[model samples]
Target: MYIIQDKRFYVCLVVACAAVFAAIILIPNWNRLERGHGASPRVLTIGPDFTRKSLAGHLVLVEGVAPHEGIEDIVSGRGTHREIALSGNLALGYRTDETWLKVEMERADFRRRNLFLWMQPSVLDHVRVYLVERHGLDAPRITEIGQIGDNDPDYLWNGVGSYLILEYKEPVSQYYDLYFNIGSTSSILLSGHIGTVEQFNNRMYASDLTVGFYISFLMTVSFIFVVLFFRSFSKNALYFALFSFMYAVNIMIPARMYELLPVAVDMNVMDIVNVQSLILLHIAGALFFRQYFELWITNEGLNSLSLWLCAMLLAMAIGAGLGGWQAIMPIELGVVAIALWLYFFEYVRQFLSGRKLSRAGLLGTGLYSVEVSTYHLILIGAVAPDGPSLSIIYLANALFILLFTLGLIEEAAVQERRNRLSLNLRLARRAEQTAVRLAREMTRELEEAKVAAEKALETERRAQAEQLRFVDVISHQLLTPVAVIKSSVASLRRSVGEAGGDDAMRLQRIETAVRRLRETIDVSLVRSRISSVGGRARKRKVVLVTELQKIVERSCRLFPSRDVTLEFDNLDLSARANIDVEMLGIAIGNLIDNALKFSDREEPVAVTVSRDGDELSIAVRDRGIGVPVDEIPKVKERYYRGSNAASYFGTGLGLDIVNQVALAHGGRLEVENAPVGGLVARLAIVGEFDPG
Candidate 1:
């Protein structure tokens, strides 16, 4: 059932059925068919309008060397030769002894016409034809028609095989004795045809077309296999190409196409090429099928056996050539025929066992095995009667080529489809593996990020708690000492009431030092709170001038010896805006304090409020030692002291805090050297303004 499903199975079945039917039809009357030309009589009579006649049963074969004299010696029985009657064409196997054929041709009621004699399988090494004319009581007129291997320019060639022009233009006798002396190292076949020149030419033309078409088909298939080999790099394709090309050349020898070659080919060399080409064809076919079916994998023993057989056959071919043992040809054909059947059955076994084998391969090899076996049987005289016609031979070859090529194409397509599916499956698996790996890596990275965020949040909570404790220590413990020192200095001033200059100055210095200490503590505590985690600006509506004036009064009270001046320009002093009041006050106070600490007592600290578009600028100018030009960029970094301000008694937190406040209010702080030779720090804030 599995084999029946394949279309090629039916095709092969049809061919087999046809062959069986033909055998059935011919087997019953094989004796009648075997007696070709109705059992050729003792004399072949050529009638008027005679197209062709076979010199079959009329021929008498003689072995060994005949007398060099004319046909008279043979006719008179004076030569050392034994005559044997032939029932059909001369099918003498390979022989080293010289042989001669004698036949009598009679013209009956036929007009004078040019008659020609045609001989087949032109591989004969030497041939001589002698025509003898006899009239009653007249001296026999003997003439040698043609000779092969004598290099005679007058020899007739029909373009298909050997021939001789009998030249019967004016026939003086109705009967003639034709003597043929033939010798060859190759198997000799003397199937002869006698016809007019027109008939001979017609047969030649037909033979030419058939053989030409077969050779052309072989050549085309060879070219196609060559292309396929290069495109796919398949060993089977290369082997098949070689097989096709060698087969084409092999057929040319039997068809006498070699005579058309530009240079004359010697019979010896042609024989060698013929034998070697057959061997090569066998080897190539074996290799092609071995690779096609993967026999090495499926049946290693059979594959090795095939290789050994091929090697043995190659060695035997060489020995046959060297020893001139032409008899080995039939053995070689038998061996190849057996091997073909073996491989065909192997394919059949695989197919029947449910293995994925190409049905076309089975069909092609089966048909091809039958064709080769039948052809070999015919050549070796195993077939009843003589060999089939040349047309039948050509048709068999054509059928083999067509079916074999179809099988190869089908197998190639199936293999390519299988390979493509395998490649796609591998690609899909690789893609799935890559996706799974990426997902795992992404999950790992996400888990790492989540853990890092939780750790950061815990660290922030601890830092905020520590900051609150530090602020508590500054407000209670640290500020208590400064307040006690201030109270003690006031009590001493009251106890030593209206004390003279030195004592009063000493007490006043103590009070000023205490007040400075408290201010430092307050600034440190405010910096801690403002820079703490989650610190953000809390905006409230307040009059601009009112806020600035309160900050200036506080700075002047803290530094009583330093003059602090507040000025407003380019805007209404009473304009109210939403800003962070506490943060802004702390920033302005630090700027004023820095101005008083860095400048001389005689120099006034100028605090000015101005407007530039929608921005509010609060600038503090002091004639103090300016920052180094190169160090100005680093001043805003936390705890960074400018190079020029190293001697100033202040922490680096002031300008840093001012910069942060400016950013929170959507503003910036600009620190630059004043044109009059001091540092001017300007705080610029952007806010919504309300007229007060």
Candidate 2:
């Protein structure tokens, strides 16, 4: 089914092209048939009421060499003159030979009126008309009526064109012969009309209106395209604008628009301009289609070929301008024909391959191909029509422009739609990617949350275990002191019946045991307070020496027999510091207590307070058993008891509490063995102290 459809498309294309070719050949022949072939001479009778008459079938044409005596030699039959009846305009292609046309006219009545002879395509190189009055053939009197050439200053121009016109002022003879001598480097086409003054004026008015409108339309379209090109920078618009403008100029040159200029331009130069405009028109057309069809993408070969053809046309135009090569016209027409066919063929091939081609482009190209080829065929004398009619060519061009403009609009819309669809597709893909990324991120976050929850649960379990162990340690420490107190009290009661010395000793033992129990409770309370407050400290200004003196006095009273001595070196008794007083006092007392508990009763534990620079130091030195060197670092850890502390009734939190207090004050606790014996624990506080 698809094969059949494809074959049908090809068949339609072939049939359409064949029909156009057939019309191009048949139409001109049909026109020629309607205007009968000029085989016999027909005399035109000019009555007083005659307005106009075409000299087509009423003329006899003869081709010969230029005579030195001019029309006299032709009239006297001095040379061989082969004359034939001309059926239409003289289309003797590109001839330099002289051609003479004879028109026979007879006056019917004596109502004399001025008569005019008009000739078209005024680019003819030379033209001379002679009026011959035959008085019964007794040596016919020949008088030159008018002479005009392309370069002649006497050339006549009407508002319509640079066409040749000759005026006859007086009509004396009843029978007259009008002889036309014409020659050209370009195509020899002489279409003439004879009419009265009113008739000539009327024809001129109509021709002016038609030609004026055609030129105006072309210029207007060219200006519009020029504006569009600047606005959009579109190559299609630019080339089409050039094509329209050149075509307008091409038409105007033949219509004798140059005659309206202030400076009289030589017709030969205008002829060069005419040929150059045609060349430019073809070049612009090639470039316009190259862009319009997007041939650069669809077919690079055709694109390059179009550019090459344009370059050749440009060279030919330059040559025509420099040397006036009238032969370039036919060559230019041939190039345009080839370019049009190539473009059309490529478009059709692309269409059949299912590439989206513009329907308007196809129609425009088809119509243009037919009309332009027909026109070229007529210009080259391949058809019966001698030349293209102005009206037909102008209408064909206008329709082609309309169709091409429609094609441009259609292509623009299609491009816009494609761009929109592509943008939507890209957006959809981006959205899909974002969704996938979000899903992956969510999965990662959920995994991380699960791990964090597990870590929190494990930490809580370990904290609970530590709390239970702490409670057990506190209970064991309290029970030891309670047991000692119970034993000492029972011994005191038993010693009541003994001597006074024994009873005093037992009371002293009970007193020491009670103090130990109170100390243990105080240590637990300080630990709880420190834990609750964390790293925060409430500081106030106080005299450091005075605060240290109170701590020393309390320690002395607690261990009276241990001889805890308070000492200082260069002590500033009135110096004040911003410190937490109670915390500092507790830390200092813990150092003294630990010294007393770890050493012998007669060890003389010394407490020294001093200041150096910004640092305040309270050192407690004991002269007894010191800490093991290896276990020194671990002694300041909470609830950490040393191996040497087995025989002592002490909680392991004293040094740790002192360290915490030192850190809270932005200071440090230093513990080391004294040089003599035992350990020296220094509570160093660094702060701004006022000395008085």
Per-model TM against the reference: 0.59, 0.56
| Candidate 2 local lDDT, 1-692, one digit each (tens) | 12222333433443355445434333322222213344366788898678688776777876453565478787777776655676655555555456677888889987777888887642367788888988874998988888866666776667454467778754588888898877553543456788988888887898788789878988987888787667556788789889889988988987887768999687678878888888888888888877776642266555556666667788889989896555556555655666677678767777878877677788778767766766565554444332245445556677888887666655545655776788798899899899889988998998898889889877975785566458557856776767777776767667675557766686777777776787777787677666556656788988877887887898788777778778877776777888888788889889988888888887888888887877878899998689899998888998888898888888888999999999998889998998878999998887568655
- Show pairs that collide, candidate 1: none
TM-score, candidate number 1 = 0.59
Supply candidate 2's per-residue lDDT for 293: 69
**Clashes, model 1:** 0
- Candidate 1 Cα outliers beyond 4 Å, as residue runs: 1-40, 62-70, 77-85, 149-170, 253-265, 293-301, 320-325, 345-357, 382-389, 423-692
lDDT of each: 0.71, 0.73
Q: Write the per-residue lDDT of candidate 1 for residues 162-199, one digit (tens) a residue.
A: 34334444366888788887755344455677888788
Query: How accurate locally is residue 601 in candidate 1, as Cα lDDT from 0 to 100?
Result: 88
lDDT of 2: 0.73
